[model samples]
Target: MEALKKLFVEFLQAPTQENFLKVRNAVLATEEFDPYTDAIDGVPKMMEAGELEQALEVMKHALFPNLVLSPGAHLNIAFLLHKLGREKDAAFEHHISQLLQEAIEETGDGTEARPYLVTRTSDEYDYLFAHDLEAKGQALAKSPDGTREHDVLTTKDGGQIWFDVTDIRKVLARRMESDGEASE
Candidate 1:
């Protein structure tokens, strides 16, 4: 656990893409390394190869040390759990994802590598956009000239721009739809 914490801090100290890759490589090279990246990478490949059990195992063993990586893993794990007809487990994963989202929103300035925290709705949306996790059905209202109209939400933390409750709903809906299709 200490080594894992060290690695986590090192990654946070320099959160750049290049630095992340470097640290990831180092972790992979270490004999004591948890197979976090391997598991994350193998999931899609295993799924594509119809190795459902293997994919599920990979997701189940994934370790998340921070919110930076937790949200995506939680989302993926939730989907996989649902695919396996484990509705309760999937819901737990989704709840974890929501909690991680909230944590990210409340986190302070991150390391020099990734300094910005998604403390506001606009920032969170931007983070999702960058990660290709944008809420699918929550289209922003656009003007005739194509500029989006900003909708603000005030939370106890501060003012968040372009906040939409539908974003959260869409995320839940996506998981539900995936399960629904699997059930059918």
Candidate 2:
């Protein structure tokens, strides 16, 4: 995990496709990687409680240690920093968020045939939020041969978007298998 952490830092420093691939591969190979959770999970509640500083601290601490490749965490941190009057830091985080987002967008267009690739479900919402859209519904889908998985989102404006969430699917599958083994 420490080596994976270093890879993530390196990728943040040089956010290119090659660096991202390294991080992605490392994440996928690790059984402990859970794309469903992040340190920033508590931020919204903290914000609602007016504990901005605490929320920011939680986000920073969890940013790297956790498998949080989603842009939403950075965006949340940026928003918190901006609210705290740290424009420079906020801008930097916002930039990082955009870089991560661009990496996902470059994977494919948001169509069923060519869905945008994302590591976490939060990223699907981030992509929609970035486009000023809202999801009216969501469903999991698979390729015709059942080799690939996707998240098909129906937009409020009666449109649809797609995300290739294969990594997340794999993570969930592994977790389910482990749970079954534990129960037995």
Model 2 segments more than 4 A misplaced: 65-67
Task: Report the lDDT tens digits of candidate 1 across residue range 65-181.
Answer: 222245566677788888878999999778656655554543333222223333123344544543445343333343345432322322233433333223333334565677799
Error of 1 at 158 (Å): 22
Q: For model 2, how does the per-residue alpha-carbon lDDT over 1-184 read when each residue is reduced to its tens digit?
A: 7888898889889888888878877877777767766556777899999999999999887765343576888898899999999999999889888988888888889998899888778889999888899999999999888988999999999998999888778888998899899999
| TM-score result, candidate 2 | 0.88
Model 2 steric clash pairs: none
Estimate the lDDT of model 1.
0.49
Alpha carbon deviation, residue 96, candidate 2 (Å): 0.6
Error of 2 at 59 (Å): 1.5
Best by TM-score: 2
Worst 10 residues of 2 by lDDT: 61-70
TM-score each candidate.
0.42, 0.88
For candidate 1, report its TM-score.
0.42
